[model samples]
Target: MSNRMRIGALLGASMAFAFSMAAHAAAPAGGLGATHYNLSSLKSDGHYDRFIVTWRPGSAERANPSLMRQSMGAALSRAGLVRATLSAQGMMQAPVQASYGRRLAIGADVLRTSRKLDRNEAAALMAQIASDPAVLHVAPDVLRHAVRDIAAPASLRPSAFKPSDTEFRQYQWDLKAPSGRATAFGDRNYGGAHVNAAWDLADGKGIVIAVLDTGITTHVDVNTKLAGAGYDFITDAFLSGRKNDGRIPGGWDPGDWTTGRPWQSMCTDEFNPPQPSSWHGTHVASTVGAERTNNGIGLAGIAYRARVLPIRVLGHCGGYDSDISDAIIWAAGGHVDGVPDNTHPAQVINLSLGGYGQCTADDPMGQAIALANKRGAVVVVAAGNDNDNAKYFSPASCPGTVTVAATGITSRRAYYSNYGRTVDLAAPGGGIYAGDRSSGEQVSDGFVWQAINSGATKPVADDSNYAGYAGTSQATPHVSGTVALMQAARLARGLKPLTPAAVLDILQRTAATPKVAPDHRIGAGILDAYAAVNMAINSGGTTSQATLLGNGVALSDLSGAKGSRTVYRIDVPEGAGKLSLRTSGGSGDVTLYVNRGTPATAEDYHCRSAHAGTSESVVLDHPAAGSWFVTVVGRTGYRGVSLVGKYLASR
Candidate 1:
């Protein structure tokens, strides 16, 4: 039979059920009478049904191993038999209609049945089979299925922040301007200044960050920088090949026209089919790694050196978990049997999309993310746009993921942005621009620069080439770009492959701390590309050194003690080799302890000499994966003695 017909028949047979009330019937007279059991009760009660039967070994002639196997096979082929397996002396068989409460057996001189069973049906089934004359023993079959429940978060707010004309022009200029060349204009356009500085270092060669959202229309800015293109997930086909008459790519490509409309209602809209919404993904992609001042046609991205890998995941209300999970895994260089491999594997996965819901570290989506991390992909998530604090959202709440919140130009929390301790850091998400020093009507002070999704036929908004959008969505790419920048910096320095932890450390440690207190909403602080890249280059260590000093010696004890000191030493054999340290508080008064070819010191001696504060640890070089010993000795007995440390080694 054909595959489809075979599947249909299987489904039909599996669903068919017949109930009848019949008294126990006598077993058929034969060499060994066999009885069947029903296991429906076991299934409903979350149990397994099993049966066991034992048969005596007979003489060689009577045993006839081949004959016994033939008999078992024949019984298994019977109409109701579901499965059968042979053991040493007998065989066990299960029937499709077997119930947990019944048991039967067939043996040489015995035909027995157990009282209606209870609890473990699998155990009861085995017991019944054991009492049979022709059978050895029966047991429940092992089965497994992939089961997971993912809590989807609430929807993100629609992009509401728009840049002013002057601000827009400033950003455009920054994109076109060269690095280190001061513009005749003052720092009034510092936003563009930051982008230019980042691009100067990026040199535009890195991983392709995939933006899985709406379909991106072919605009000058986007087309000029296009590395390659693929289908928007909604279409289930390539967006570039839709309506082409074999010459020009053409078709009914639905863009982001349904932005303000409800997803459900848009189902019936002629222009908005169940296909990729245009602008959302495009805009997000542009913000992440748009092409910089090459031909100077559009805005610049934080990682001007990086490329984009647009993988549309959102359409209609929102994409499904299964699809998003697939996109995430695929984007991170994972292999999915049927789908084409993501040609350009993304080192940084930017999720500008999120929803409301509690997601634990163990959820399937979280598991998939963990898998991505194992493969060296850094995931950046938006801390939802709900403007709430207490609740956590999916993909963001996923463990080991970098969740970002939104901040305005003044370094204040954006009113529409979400907040919580879960937020790792914040970035310029735009603010309510109070129109020109006069009318205070709230307008959007564009803080985000990205590509706009124009419909395939025309630009959706007047400023289709480029526009400013503000949200935690926009903020997310800032962090993603920083991650890319750090990676590129590490590459340029010839450092080891950047791990997720190292990336997070660089971003958090060098981030620009806001000027205000209780800055909980904005997270660690605003993103600082210069500081982060500097950290990567400086932290890439090529030398190895160990020093021994008494307690209360600062890292200045090792160096001259003038500049910022980043060094660390450890005593655990596992933490020896190369070390880096960073000190806060006093003007560099930390000390290092090495065994120096002597026998190991006592734990208390090491702890006491180390000042034993919680912040101190001994880091090691990369290939120095094994254990090593060194100690961190604090300089002062004063109460607040804390220091941070790390190390890098040759792999």
Candidate 2:
């Protein structure tokens, strides 16, 4: 794909703030911008009772959208879309009906079924809709919900521990996880990213990190980190419970609670019980920037000095990917008509929520991510708490994102933290447990701590707040906060802003793998924020280094998926006879090669260390006179490797 053309196809230049405003066209209504999908779907909590059908381009609907929706309903009636859908789904005996709505921005119309049909039946109807030559695309109005509260308990237990005055710090057990050991609070010690030390160097002064979840509450812990009134991307007034209020500009949480009565089915979900608004965004924002040591306030944040951009994508019931994608682009300083220019464009964005689906090239989430990356925003995503392969989740699976997994106090991958090749790194996702009285008080801490609102049923910000939550949702902010710290350090050092790719590279290269046992599923390894920031600040962004070699000196640098040659200059004495070079000590396979004279390019190499496996060796039968250059290359995936050189005297 021509990345240039795809990037140029930015919705920022053409989409309105929301679909209703599509007619006021400085841009198309800010529906799913540029995030076109041949067939995009969602995971609804209620049921799959609605399907959206778009009239194909060149169809009569192209000329008269109003009459077209009307005629299609008549045509589908004659064609019997409901019966066809039922029969095709082998639900011929099932009660199914259809009602059509007006034209949608995707050039489609909504077709709500009588009752919630099974997911298979909805897919079946969508298949039938696609076959109509007058249709461009068809997909379920898939339900999308908050990634948190997969299961929120009726009541939460606030820990009894209190911190000192210099630090009102709650037990941030995620900071250090000692392998195979347990903390005093009965939480396991495992692979933590070492965040405490990282905070000493940088506090994310000017960077803005956007949190796209329920929305932030007025919790004192993070009150000062607000990055203006971030937009509420929830376009549906009904879902937002505020009639006539569409995509307003504000970052406050209104609450997302539901009561399950058929007459008022807004809170009813076939799979889950009634739940509170979660205040998920507030909790996550605190992890990234709650003022620590604030005259004995609550607790400290990863980047207390950094500000947060609050964008609400999830509300009552759940949310749609269409709205979520729009918020992503807008947060990265991209344009969305009707939404004012973001004064605080975020350098980093944290998505602690995701829906169940792969982020393919045609997916809107992927497109949004691409736009964010193009605009210099590093997107960090949670790998999900499903304990399944992270590759199946949206933005997490999307390329150009830093996908993170969860590790507990014991420094091991959390039991519920999803794993796979797609995950980039792991951080402290709490595994705090309660002691089993029957089991002689075996301690287990099931969550991580941060400040939250006082109300359990609704979000009511209270100063006296501190609570714990678990999930990769918690792990993600850890990575995002450190990224802010890294960026802050970079700025302080007068270095150029780090691109998304550069940020990922430095974090991965500096990560420390556990000595206990290596788990490939956790990406490079557990995060070491201190080590990462150190590298980002002191390394000066050099991919390779210049070096002077001794007779037997060795040089090395960590190479990534893309092979960057680590070059070294060697001086040979007049009496030097033969030269030998090789590579060893690396997690990934690599090769070493040498050139006789000062060749301007890597292609001019005269001999190579082509021996196989990770280590390669080659010897020159005779010696050359001038300065010699030797290089090590990552033959495969990225890894840290060593290149050794030896000059043998005449034998």
Candidate 3:
């Protein structure tokens, strides 16, 4: 029998610590409202039972469990009962029994309440907790689910040099190139990441990708030969579905099926019912590097030769940001307490799960991502499945992350994909409907197909199974896996690994333009694995130093602090009369420099435009052909700056 417990069914840890130390007292009355408690996210999730609290570095709460428990319990009692702000009929009460969950790698503590509370009640309790001067930050441990939704399969024609994997030709439309060919379903199979072409160049040798999700189960297609020493980062015993409470070795999915009474009561909503175990990590991991390709068995992986370091973060009823934050750091070779140091540091970290919240620079997950980027790991995150602006989602909106949006087979933004300027690019997340639009009947072959387990609730006899699921969750791995191939190709040429920023630049620069205009702002374009790998092989590990640009669209929301410089290059066609470059919108002062055939700098440029604010332009009549480099130098800290280029017809 499996050790899986129902969601929210596990009892809190023993509160046996002595409470003799003097804890930080609550703030004076009327000061609670002034604190930053993430009220917007709290109001959106609508239900929260557990909260994560980060204490000041030198505070007693960070050093002593007794002091931490005392301070938190006292704050809970002080909050008392209150009426819900959004609903008059709803009541909010503090938990009678409060307990410590686990300390995170980022030095945050997870605190659990006796039961779930409404958003307003949780807000009130959060206000009380934030009132303490020692408390640096406190936010709900909002549960983040797998961003994918299930669907059926579709028919597809053969691509050039099809893999021997049984499902490659017919069902794996996501891996093929955009043929614009009509499928058995209404939509054409044109939204693939074009991984088939990239396969001939690089198979992700010598690269490691970490999948931070529900973890990997047994799969024949997924390669474990070069696997790293993975870990299950889920600290909660109930969530881990293990007997022990603390983290354990081995990143195995013990099943995240939220079925039956208690789990149903906790995880279900009006539109959502109790879900079966998704085997999300398995499918995601396979997409990155399922090695059983060309063996006449399953399906092809984007990076078949690369190592996948499966790190379990999400579990039953979703995972906490605290667990996820630690997982991100650990996967990128950062040290975490108690957990062994990762011997195999991943070059790419894929986060296919996230919760409702804007990720601030100070947020634990945000800091963790920044650190991961500093460690040279490209962090790829899902743009979320909320079908709203990705800026409102954690990690997706986090700085230094390559947030990915979802596209259907027809290359349209998936109906359920979150889109915004935060998204870096789009991938085949599969549209589960007729027209790849919202509110249509579900169709076959509308989901990204990959390996999965047959069991509905837990691991079953057969593990080599394939199914289709759709979401930005599925789209994210396409990018992560492609990054592995790019890095592997770069390394094969004796070049140093591309930095996170460099990787993003290459990806955005080489991405394929969408066949149809996106309904919302997704990103630069659809991921082109071949172009990305080719660019990686050619560039000398300085991909972001000078990015390539084109006309017809503006690069929006460009921002930089004072004295920072960002450069781009656009090729002018022969016989062009004028090359017009413009920068407008947003705030603060900036200068634009244009140079022909070389990188532009302040001292050496053919033309320059300096404005007090963002409005700046440079026009060169009878402009010389070849590469024209445009540089943007910040006079003051600027944001939301849009840069556009246009080549006029010759007179």
> What's the TM-score of every candidate structure?
0.56, 0.71, 0.76
lDDT per residue as tens, model 2, 299-379: 667877888888888777666666777788888988776578777888989888775556654455666788889999999
| Alpha carbon deviation, residue 80, candidate 1 (Å) | 28
Compute the lDDT for candidate 2: 0.63
Off by over 4 Å in 2: 1-46, 49-121, 124-141, 149-170, 176-188, 224-228, 260-271, 291-294, 434-446, 515-520, 539-565, 568-651
lDDT of 3 by residue, 1-651 (tens): 111111111111101112100000112223223454555355433666788888988987889877887887788677773322334556544335577777877778888877677665677788888889899888778766566454453222222323345457666778888888765444577788889999989999898899998877776556755333799888877777777788888887778877864577866664456677777788788887854677776578889888899988888777778888998999999999989999999999999887556776667787789889889999999997777778767778899999999998888898778898889899999888877877667665577767777677777643555666777888999999999999999788787888886687668666777888888988878998988888777654221567767774799999997545688888888899888899999987777878887776533568888645789999888787888989887655789999988887556
Better of 2 and 3 by TM-score: 3
What is the Cα-based TM-score of model 2? 0.71
Which residues of candidate 3, in runs, are more than 4 Å off?
A: 1-36, 81-98, 153-166, 181-187, 226-228, 439-441, 541-651
Instruction: Rank candidates, lDDT, best first.
Output: 3, 2, 1
**Each model's backbone clash number:** 69, 27, 3
